[model samples]
Target: MFDKIYDVIVVGAGHAGGEAAAAAANMGSSTLLITMNLQNIGQMSCNPAMGGIAKGQIVREIDALGGYSGIISDETAIQFKMLNKSKGPAMWSPRVQSDRMRFSEEWRLKLERTPNLDFYQEMVGGIVVEDGKIVGVKTSLGLTARGKTVVLTNGTFLNGLIHIGDKQFGGGRAGERASTGITKELTDLGFETGRMKTGTPPRVDGRSLDFSKMEVQPGDVDPEKFSYSSSTKPLTKQRDCHLSYTSPQVHEMLKEGFDRSPMFNGSIKSIGPRYCPSIEDKINRFADKDRHQLFVEPEGWNTVEYYINGFSTSLPEDIQFRALREVAGFEQVKFFRPGYAIEYDYFPPTQLKHTLETKLVSGLFFAGQINGTTGYEEAASQGLMAGINAALLVQEKDPFILKRNEAYIGVLVDDLITKGTEEPYRMFTSRAEYRTLLRQDNADFRLTPKGYDLGLASEERLREMEIKQKKSDAFVGFFTNTSVPPEVLNPILESKDSALVTQSDKMIRPFSRPNITMDDMRKIETVEAFIRENELDTEVLQQAEIQIKYAGYIEKEKNNAEKLNRLEGIKIPENFDYTRLKSLSYEATEKLSKIRPVTVSQASRISGVSPNDISVLLVYMGR
Candidate 1:
């Protein structure tokens, strides 16, 4: 039945697969997306939310790079929040509570409307390999399809095993059947496979819970969206989430099922997410805590189901219900389903290149949970990168790889391939060394140009980014050239408890004070007139202010990054015999050989390779 070979075939249709397919097809590749069930494409398997902490910045980065995640998230968002607003701009992250059904519907609709893309409903059973390269895929229904390149984004589906208390079942998700064949086949072909576990809290009927006892958690008063696209509407109305605490009584009840709990009973052998541990695990780990916080989030605008966040567990249904009822707001909670944990197969990311293509197989790539990452945003970013690289490979173009200082996507891929995660990897602002330069406010400024050059980003997007940059730069120049007298600046500074200026100086001088802000400066008639004359927008003004205020720190970080990038510029030959270097330590030799690092910088990041080893290599290369 397979007549023509596709340029790219993407397996699975979750966040990772959807982004991958869209990226490839949008880049002019003839792409096919195969899923076990098409109806569940882009389903939010765990919670009805997108973006949080560093994950939110990742969504914006994805949007800035011509990916659909931010656009879809904005379209489906029921509430919007810019987390860490109290902190610096570098820490600011935009998150959304989405309409569960709408999020999936938007994804499917977009994928359907995309050009050069086709969809098929089938479980990929095996891959057809020819001379160390992927040629096609075999389906469970005795059908085969050919493709030049294939991206596997099979999230939580490879030999998936679900656990609920002492009961176990084989399933990819709560209502989805587990996929087989490919994991075993890949392992047989010399891929090292490992198991990882993740869990979701139980879905409960919202109407059954008493909201009066819970604390109201409202959305931001002045909310913003994820997408940089003008087509996305701003959120004017928002649903309020509730916060309730699991009391000591609730913990006691949860502990009663500890013996039967799959996590503690030895039924689950895989490691779970370290940041979002199970409810049972939390209580056991922190015995002295009197209560734990749970945010009761709505599933959708119309649905009666609510997600019991922070209460994830694999305890028995009876135990789950009883323990939840003891919580403040969940005194009469009714269950939609009990919480469960699932363990799935993942390949160690060290076996892949920065482009996400496997080292052992040509034209074969992996993304999302298959690479041992844990969030929707994280998965989507990986998919977008993998898809872009795969399409470029088929077109005989150089692979697209982001540098660590450029985007969080780069930091994530680098950490995975260089260090190789033992536990599931999740992104955090603290993870980036040059975070000040990698702020969410400047993602478009940083990456939209690259996306535009790749044909994934539109001319319109590039134009918008250029305009923003020009205006911000002009504002900064104005601040540097203009002098503000004490009469114009002292009143504003004193009102904000900042020291009064003695004489007229460049506007940027006073603007650098910690207590002073652009708003305070705008209060001055001269500054207001200047803003009106220049037609500066709030975003432009803010960007300029931050640049001036943090100029010292930003330049310091840039210098540090430049020094490290020198090592990165030194390319190491592929398959170089590290063992031949007798001066290197055994541990360093083993790690360097196994990782086969593409650059001297990547080799330096490997655990066993120290700074001395890097110096040794640099000396050898110098000779």
Candidate 2:
């Protein structure tokens, strides 16, 4: 027995589903979130951390667009650090080590307080579809809840199987059971499914380890929070993580379990994340290496549990314990939970559109690990975008799809829906072609306007952004128009190892190369006075500096983005008989027919499609 209808229904309550439900409800849509266990909402399943490298940028972008990830992360964080401080602004990412219990509790509390959001404790078994469109979902207890749109964020629960050495059993995680019925039902409905594997390291008791021998890795002295929300503050006190390395003895011990290891023993047929391989795999692959590093991270401020990072394994408990003891400073380690590998069903993202909806089923969407993505930031960003689009779809508004040039989230989605991934995809600065223009410091400037239009971002945020933009623009203009005399600014320039200016020139110009700072702009008393009165935040100042210093590169990227947009706008007719075109290769025809890309740009991106094939299609379209 259930309600007549909800605007949106989200299955599962991990990172993706939690954010999806909150976002849809926050946007004024009636939402229902269904999960097998409500007590574990937003569980940090893999690591007790949030935001790292490129993933941190995604969280900031989500926060700027009014998503809850950053807020939850900020509230629960036990330690905060800004990664890559010595690097360019493009690479700076804010990360936090969170208290596992607090992170989950904060998520549940926040969801409970959110308006238009309702929670139900149940496992969704199958979707109710009519005329190739999703109408609702069927739960394990035979209860059916109808909704206009349904987002499935099943995580690693769909027909899940866990492996440890020679033993294998049905399970989502260590204590949770696997979800059944949905995979088979979807397969019968012509949805193709594949198995993906992921693993987590063992959790050890902090008191069992000797801290005197390990190197201490403490959080930043002046830490930064992830959220743009007013409720957060910078971290004052921080936790200290220890660093230790695996010894030859540890590697030798692990090898004894190789034959029984599910991954190497051929018991597991699923593909796992290539980047985050288990310790066994690493040892096997790098047989000659004497040691591998492991981070001893605390689970929380209050708990005595620590995550033994870089020790992910599915070997027998005896082997695991023995190997762990061989490592430096782990002579008496005790495990809170044993490491295991999980295999779960995932429909390859090649079947999804840019809006995160299934191409085969209207009003049906996917997010998180269900989409073969691995990180919390990846899942949360997808949930936010998918939720926004689902709400817009219900209101008969245009779908909101971010482009590759716009954000890291945009690049992530585009890569998923376009080329697709054979393995779990993680974000990195190297993945973004125009990262110089897509820095983390300016996420608000990049996305707040769209969020404001969608009713997600607040007016105050927009106003603040607008004010910042105006001030930065005025300052940049003043720097260009009013130049410093060589006599006044030469010593300052020389001190920074920059060439002394011969005449009045723009401070950001190459003539003032390598050492342009706000101090240099102080040569103009008006500019100096303005900076004193405004006292802009470091983030704003950095963003403004990047815009001014890299103006040419930014413009070039925007022009290239425009050129790419032209191909994106060109529509390709579906089921257009690619087989009949003799000019196309056999591989191109097969791939084009399968993917049925909506645009010429998408067609060009498909793995097997060649440039010649694209030219033939372009000619056929009479472009």
| Best-matching candidate per TM-score | 1
Global CA lDDT computed for model 1:
0.93
Report the alpha-carbon TM-score of model 1 versus the true structure: 0.99
lDDT of 1 at 539: 74
lDDT of 2 at 133: 89
Please provide, for model 2 over 371-474, each residue's C-alpha lDDT reduced to its tens digit, 9 standing for 90 to 100.
88898999999888888878878888999888778899999998887777878888999999878768788888899898898998889888877887887776
- Clashing residue pairs in candidate 2 are none
Please state every model's RMSD to the true fold in angstroms: 1.0, 2.0
Candidate 1 stretches greater than 4 Å from native: none
Q: How do the residues 157-184 of candidate 1 rate in per-residue lDDT, one tens digit apiece?
A: 9999999988999999998999999998
Q: What is the C-alpha lDDT of each candidate?
A: 0.93, 0.87
Q: Give per-model TM-scores.
A: 0.99, 0.96
lDDT of 2 at 16: 94
What's the TM for model 2? 0.96
Alpha-carbon runs more than 4 Å astray in model 2? 510-512, 515-528
